[model samples]
Target: MKRIAPAAERNKDPILEVLRPLLRDGATVLEIASGSGQHVIHFASVLPAVTFQPTDVDADARRSIEAYRAETGAKNILPSLALDAASDTWPVHSADAVVCINMIHISPWSCCEGLFRGAARILPAGGALFLYGPYRFFGVFTAPSNEAFDASLKAQNPAWGVRDTDQLLALAAETGFAHEETVPMPANNHCLVFRRL
Candidate 1:
């Protein structure tokens, strides 16, 4: 089945703009929590020289990723794999860069911790880890819309909510990553970039 994520449709281009310069040609990019596979297909198409490895924990998400890859005929995209950020062992051991979009806030905080832990093990020193989504700054919401969104997320699951960027940075540091840059995106979201230390 081909599923659609409206947010993916809206944000793909903007995300690509940032990614274009960051990821080099012939590099492999591991995309975590690749829901609906929309973003990876788009990116693979746009960055033909780069290989995209998409992964998700959900069976449906994996199917959708394969569906989108088949539909797009993107040769650069590999078969979707089952990957959970919190797992002790990942299916793949290394990648040139790692990307996680709109994932941390929707999952438990432990997932974020696991993501960093796994990323630290997989990425080489100076490898980049990119994160995209809404996040609180210094324990305060950047906008009212983000605050409302956080509230809604928490309502759905108390463990899920917009995370504080400072806290995330601290966690990343513990896992041997350094926060590098933060770029503002559309709809009050942000793209955070980190480097393996």
Candidate 2:
């Protein structure tokens, strides 16, 4: 059976609303960790001018993304590629924008650090790097659900937990990407946008 991430269904449109204005026309958008490929097909179908490049390190996930691309007949969506956000050498070195959804909390913290370095390397001046997921702002915002989510992530992997936005900003700044904006999303989440400085 095919898998589904409920959050994808929930947030894709809201994200698209915010992304519509932020994304430049005819720009190339690289989506890291394109888990089920649902968002790529939907985004590509909706935003025809912006090219969507979906990527992930997992072979199975890549196949899933490819399958969706073929099934949906999305011409604007590029072929899926193997891209581990923790790597310094991405297959494609240049993109107008890079996006990652729901990855930072599930993967090791090093993945976020690598994402900053990679975004810094690939994005041009004024290019955007977007991240969508739950975040704790400076160790504040003590919602019970968020606390439970954090505990669950830690239980699964010692290295995994929802990130703190201030810490993330520091890392992004270190990698030459400055914090630009933050958009609140449904279900205890946020869309953090940064730009290459």
Residue-level lDDT tens digits of model 1 in 79-193: 9999999998999899989999999999998899999999999999999999999999999999999999999999999999999999999998899999999999999999999
Q: Which 10-residue window in model 2 sums to the lowest lDDT?
A: 1-10
RMSD of candidate 1 to the truth, in angstroms, is: 0.7
lDDT of 1 at 15: 97
Go through the candidates in order and give each one's C-alpha lDDT: 0.94, 0.89
- The residue-level lDDT of candidate 1 at 60 comes to 98
TM-score for all predictions?
Answer: 0.98, 0.97
141-165 per-residue lDDT for model 2 (tens digits):
5477988999999999999998999
Q: Which candidate is the best by lDDT?
A: 1
CA-only RMSD, every prediction? 0.7, 1.1
Clashing pairs in 1: none
lDDT of 2 at 150: 94
